[model samples]
Target: MPNLRCCSSSSLSLPAESYIYQLCAAGPASLAAISSDNSLRRFDRSSLALLPDGLVKETHAAGVSSLCAAGDGLLATCGKDGTVKLWDARRAGAVAVFQADKGMPLLSLACNASSHSIVAGTELVKPDAFVLFWDTRSPGKTCRQYVESHNDDVTEIQFHPSRPSVLLSGSTDGLVNIYDTTVPEEEDALVQVVKHSSIHHAGFMQDKAVYALSHDEMFSIHPVTSADEDDSHADEVKAVEFGDVRPVLKAEYVVQVLVDAAGSYVASGRTSDRSLSLTPLVHTPEFHFEQSNSWMLPGAHGEEVVRSVLFDSESRTVYTCGEDGHVRLWKEEPASSAELSSIRPTKQRKEKGYKPY
Candidate 1:
């Protein structure tokens, strides 16, 4: 268990109706956030202070839905406007825009630096939903499209942090699909799919597992590789259920799930009286999650939803964004022996089965 406490907080004086939907860390010292007002804002990571003159007014025609920190000081964002735009962290204007067909709203986005590719997931239209890809060097035109990959709107897409050719997508249709982007054909590109009840978000846990959050507030962790190399178990992937099934963190609504950089803990942004809850990946021999911990900022988002959370491993600091249009920073407080003991598992966690290390 780790000590957690809010050290500071800040926000712009936007209309009460404005809400922050997404957050991405540009680097150790800077963060980029997107809001319901169709604006993109930059903040100083340490102070949680809005940078002077660091606002991009109305970057999108509609509310921005997704954002990612693309390498090389670039941030990628997409919106209901059916456009994907990239912004240089050092400037105020967009550097590139990738347009989609009419009525196709971009719902999710991901960028792979090694492959120099940017992918956007679009809303479900009459014909079908699509996963659009573009080469960062040639952004005006789409390089390829994966049609019929998802039957419903794609809610999340993420590239494998270390594997350039691998990608993951989660949809409202309750399916988590993995794609081998090197494959040219849409049908052949899909390598695997993990079914859930209704996925709210999905992402790779390092490179070994895919973790998904359901709309029902339940979560599951599945192996990234299929059980059988023969392809017989293609549709029968196994998963370890948590949350509702095991009752790890008592959260009302989980806005986002994040894996710490060191992979020691999994944090969830809980809304409706916003707070950040953490669960230790290490478990006791009884196969139960350790006693979890949570932290709430002093005047935090006041009943608003926490949309996203970012953990800085080097500094051991936490950054969070919420529907209240504020970005808050939290740091670990020195823990006393009694406080430390209370957070540890009643029994020592076995290093044997499913150790995150």
Candidate 2:
């Protein structure tokens, strides 16, 4: 019902119901693409062409659940196989396999800028989940040991782009913890811990909110500055209710959230119609567009579950894919009439079942 339309459409076919678990842009042109559905497949940005380079077989013994690209054409994948693998994307060979706690599946991975060390997080099973720090410098070194971290299944992990020592992770157990890799022995010395729902996605935004996408269309914008610091919390929230909690903005179901480098705009993807809506952080209460573009990519796998959306700020090009095996690329444009839909305000808020405090 939202003003949603595909800016353009292209489709691809795949062998199975491939849910995109991870994505990374290759080369400086950002013209190359890599994704994990059944296996790692490379695609050409122009003409939505499937390139000859692809990992036909699944990355892990079970299935590839996550992926990340490090510098020098290095790639990492983790999944039900309970192992983390490092690969040379250009060479088409695996360099090493880092095993997780026996039987525990690796769900997520984050790489430092150099890609020498990787931080891996595992899915929650029962009593707890763990995050492992791996040294990938020596590919010949066969053995690996995991440092137990977190009280529940680690849902996601991320590394500070400039600082390798700083790491961030969220878990189903409602904990967001920061770790200092420099002190590998200090297992529980968290730089910061947040009590909230499992974080689906997270990234630093203008030294302000740490934007994250939860399971639902819900998006949480956590103010980076402490609540004790009023000078930082400027925007007044409209829809979502918090007991003076300043991190969250509109608590609607959001599949993905990305902030441009300049922090001028935030793009949050909506899963329902396969589109992303843009919200301006500078304007606060007035979010300009909702359901901006319908993402359509040909040569996609089955199912159409959107895996990830990567934005090239310089080019304003957006690359996204889902279970529908193919990845779609979109170029950003000004807000069209198709983006402005009627908002009942209070009525829609009530229908959302917002708890009035």
Candidate 3:
């Protein structure tokens, strides 16, 4: 069975009465987080120690909502103050800022590594919601604005890891839309749509599949097939719901869904319970729930809701941040040879109070 152990742990204190909302692995040994106190802080990945002179305090006038690690030592963040800021991780201030019209609240953010474009989603307004795009090289100017995609608040947005022109956005209206950003017009950019009850987060898995987490604690995976040359089969190109929807963490909500760097496992952070649960993706045909090789890291946040979990597969380490304004580190432990050899075979038997049906 898979073994996940908490080998060592450390915590870092942020500004007074701060609440962390998002966390991202900035580098192999470093992490970055955004908080309700309108601050962005960085820490050592292994020790969870606050890096001296590694803070950008009050960069946003309001609470920060989301964070992402852009390429080349850059960090991207969006805030309720209706702006997206790009910061150099080695420095203490923002290098560029992207603003929205009328100072609309920016709730979600994503950065495209291939095209060097930044996308920001807005909170719900009376008539419609919008997704703003900007070129990273030429900041402070709007490249395009998509206003007809979602009807409610835009909750999450992500760019395809391998495809530079593809983008994904999810909203509280229970719709997940995929768009081809290369198209010049907003009306012609939409490629597909996947509907659910209410979406909390959505992201691509290895470029072919997309996974979505709902507010009701359910998860679903969809498969995207290649388009057919024949026009008669064009409708068949829509994403097909591929697998059973299952409860991920059995909590009120799942803050985030994270896949390991090697794509070997998937994990989720649970609210109210303060735990991180992991499940191996590669399983045998005879796999049973009792032998599924899954484990939980309990007492993860100590009565606080864990907002984010980041994994480093190279070193087999995990980092988590929470509402308590603390970042914690967990390392895997290998089982001993003696402990494995001591196991004895068990005899199969029926339950004590049951009979054959």
Candidate 4:
């Protein structure tokens, strides 16, 4: 990967001092973000200027917890208020709300445009937790819900990049469950489960392989046989466990393993040196991280945790948001003759995989 350098930084003036929680490419030229201040806003992707009619204050009664692209230039956000709202960036307020029968805080969300579907995972409420589904065409009522797969708050939910009905959910209960939503029965819906510890982020990476990152930084990748079918069993799927990534990445914490146009990259931060590293996940021949291919950015957010990282392929720039309440952009530093000569193409090694034990 190219050595990324900080180019520009922008700050969003929310109602109060609040952390920028999530960032997503809203449309062609706009970047959408949600915050702890219970608001949603858009900014120019190039200049990082706040766009006109782009600010929507108090999007949720409490605070927005998650944001995801809902297709057709729309954005979806859910919050402690327990409802999912769809937004058209050109407008000021939510266009529609996906309501749940019981108002429970939602923690994670995922949407599929091809299937006209949206899924939201709720925080554990007494005896039950839920993964509610709604058809984008009809947002007034939830269409389906899975109540038995997870016993704790669902921290992440993602659909197969190409297979919408194939869903993945990870939770505080240390289980990452894969389900075929087309299977109406809750028991039958759950086809696979991978064990972990309090998952912070889990999703479909390249080739639809499932990666689960725990809150304490335990990372692992579970491979699937094929993407065409969703019945792959968890017992058969051996996980390549990389326990406690803080040592491997030489960092204080692992932020997220985000997949962009290129592939999945692990974002990590080292507070002692105040640096951030993006290690590319190479899975072509096998699964491994090319640390030599990592792009390091020093003075990263000044000791604050970076929450989200977005790589724009068109501009070839990196955008990162953090607890510092700022969105910073980084571009490739012009390589010197010595630096250019030192750069050699890295290859994925056929390393042995670790079981999820």
Best by TM-score: 4
lDDT of each: 0.71, 0.52, 0.68, 0.78
Per-residue lDDT of candidate 4, residues 1-357 (tens digit): 456678778886665456788899899888988876777889998888888888888888877889999899999999888899999866667899988777888989999999999999989997888888999888787999999888899889998877677889889889999887878898987878888899888987644478889888889988744334444543444568889888888888777886755566788887667788887777545567778778787788786667788877556677888777888888778772223222222331011121111
By how many angstroms RMSD does model 3 differ from the true structure? 8.6
Relative to the true structure, candidate 3 reaches a TM of 0.83
* Model 3 / residue 197 / CA error / Å: 1.9
Model 2, which residues run further than 4 Å from truth?
1-13, 30-37, 139-149, 206-208, 223-252, 264-275, 283-305, 332-357
On lDDT, the candidate that comes out on top is: 4
Rank the models by lDDT, top first. Answer: 4, 1, 3, 2
* Worst window of 10 by summed lDDT in candidate 3: 347-356
Write one digit per residue (lDDT tens) for candidate 3, span 1-357: 434566555445666655666778787678888776777888887667778877787867877888898888888988888889988866658889998878888888999766989999888977889999988888886789999999888988998776778889998788888888878887778878878756777877655566666665456666543222333423322343423223433443355556533553345445455566655443122111222445567777766666677776566567776667777777554653222111111210112211101
Tens-digit per-residue lDDT, 100-198, candidate 1: 867489888999888889998888885678888999889786889888878888888898777778889888788899998888997888988988866
1-357 per-residue lDDT for model 2 (tens digits): 222223443434455544444457655643333344447665555555655664546677777777777667666777777887776646666777777666578777787756477777777666667777667775432233334556676777887545566677876566666666555364544555655665666555444445554443344455443323353433533222122111232313333555545333443333344444444444235332322222222222232345566656564455766545556666533453332212111111113221100
> Candidate 1, which segments miss by more than 4 Å at Cα?
1-3, 226-238, 243-247, 268-274, 283-288, 292-300, 334-357
Deviation of model 3 at 210, angstroms: 1.0
Worst ten in a row by lDDT for model 4 = 348-357
For each candidate, C-alpha RMSD in Å?
6.9, 7.8, 8.6, 5.7
